[model samples]
Target: MKRIILSGGGTGGHIYPAVTIARELENVEPVEILFVGTPNGMESRIIPEEGYRFASIPASGLKRKITFENVKILCRTAGSLWKARKILREFKPDVVIGTGGYVCGPILMAAALSHIPTMIQEQNVIPGVTNKILSHVVDRVALGYKEAKARFPVQDKCVYTGNPTRPAIREAKRDESREKLGIRPDDFMVLIAGGSRGARNINNAMLGVHRHFRDTPGLCLYHVTGTRDYGNVLKELGEVDERGYYGSSSRIVDYQHDMPSAMAAADLVIYRAGAVGLAEVAVRGLPSILIPYPYAAEDHQTYNARVFVAAGAAKMIEDKYLTAQELIQDIEELHNHKDVLAGMAEAAEKLGKASAGADIAHMALELAGKKGER
Candidate 1:
């Protein structure tokens, strides 16, 4: 059996893609897969739960500016490389792939130096520093956004494969999903989420949206306020009942565990512009109102949002200027114009790479086969 090692962590954006690709690989062929990530990252827990063999190597991000702490991190990175190399030697994998994160740096770099077929997947228009550096050494760079190629020095190595998401995302049926979510067939379901931790600004803005849409027939607002802000958001909207319903049509929750179903049920989405979320939205052909987190590293979320905007798949509202009024106006415009909404949905569908996981899986196996040939 071909052996493979997949490494990436730090956030869900990095972790989920690795998991998806691993799942696809298993479906494609009989392979032995091992995941490597930092011991402290969420991957340490998530990968094991997914029933994959996982190994952890010490890894951490470097500070941007020169500092004593950066020096210390460099030393730790050197140690990480040693550990990663040791793992590779022991596993004897045919191919190694990294999604994107500081944790993957040492692992991918070690694989390259060991002459193993290696690749890195970047899931944003602006590549992370880790992926950008690894791009120079790895055999191939799989891009979530085609626009990201210009940002990398090794242009020939880059391929636009799009972002991988849960298989359920592509398979989610609208009717079934809506039924599961208690949404009517004719209800205009507006799904609002701000990532796993929730965005306070988004929660705050939704209060106004609730006030406007409450009791509005044929409209339902399913808002996810995140765990930390749920109580505060509920308190501010004092009339909300114990069940987190503000009006006849509005429902609030701290999190949405069934996001694929939620996305399938949604007629429109208002959320942050994280690449993973965008990938899910695109696959579902849902038009979005994107409010990028202004503080994201290098403001990459805005760049990701702009790609959708340029494609006519979504509208961008900078977080600095995102008000309930602005959000409500955008929603009303889309709700009122069926032709425009349909066009945007078509555009989003055009951007979806539902085959991304399969493509990357095949790519990894192809690289492994080539190495075996050599």
Candidate 2:
């Protein structure tokens, strides 16, 4: 079996791509895939659930500002480098693939020092610090955006493969999804998602604006409030719908695990512009209104949103300017403009790389010079 160690986690953006790439590799080879990530990070749960072996290392990010905690994190990271080395030695991976997170730092560093072939996948237009640092040591860098090449130190080693999106989202058919989601053929369906954990700002805005949609004609709303805010959201919705107000027009889900069905059923998507969400929206050709998280590392979510805006695929509403009234108006205006929505969807489709997982998997295999064995 060809052994591959993939490292990344903390968020679905980092973990999902690693999982997608691993799944793709399984199709071509009898693979032994090990995922190395921080124990507390989301990958610890997500990776193993996907039926892959997962190893945890003591990894944490250093704060940008000067603090004792930052120093302590740095010391811990150095120790993690040693622990990661031991794991790599015993597993003897043929190749290492890092998706981009602090967890990748120790694992990729160990792989590099061990003289193992290493590759990094950068998920944003502005590469993360982990992938940027790995670029110097890794054999190849796979990028989500072509423009990312200029931002990386090792431009020559980079290839734009786009980000690997969930297979369900990539292959979702519009009509089939709409049917599955119980969306009427003529209904103007709007999808509002705040990501897996849900965004507090987004939930608040939606609550403030719920009345407008309740009164709108022929408009349907599918609201995905993250699990964290589900109870509060349900309470608010109950208060609003108590008077028979929403008229068969809204579905409030705490979380929609079947996001492809939601995306496929929607005429428009309002979401945070995380890298994974952006890739899924683009692949599904869904025009979106993006509200980027301002506090994201290096303000990368804004950069991610700008990519779609530049492509005429999405319109960005800064978090600071977001209000329930403003959100309602924007949705109403967009819904009224079917031509623009269709145009944006077309533009989004143009930027889609539906087979990014297969592309990156093939690249990793080529870097390892391994023939298919599965």
The parts of candidate 1 lying over 4 Å away from their true place are: none
Instruction: Give per-model TM-scores.
Output: 0.98, 0.94
Report, for all candidates in order, the number of backbone clashes: 0, 0
Clashes by residue pair, model 2: none
What RMSD value applies to candidate 2?
2.8
Tens-place lDDT per residue, model 2, 184-231, is 888898999988889999988988677666656688888888999978
- Any idea what lDDT model 1 has? 0.93
Which candidate leads in TM-score? 1
- Model 2 gets an lDDT of 0.87
Q: Relative to the true structure, how large is the alpha-carbon lDDT of every model?
A: 0.93, 0.87
Give the per-residue Cα lDDT of candidate 1 at 246: 83
Candidate 1, residue 249: CA error in Å? 1.4
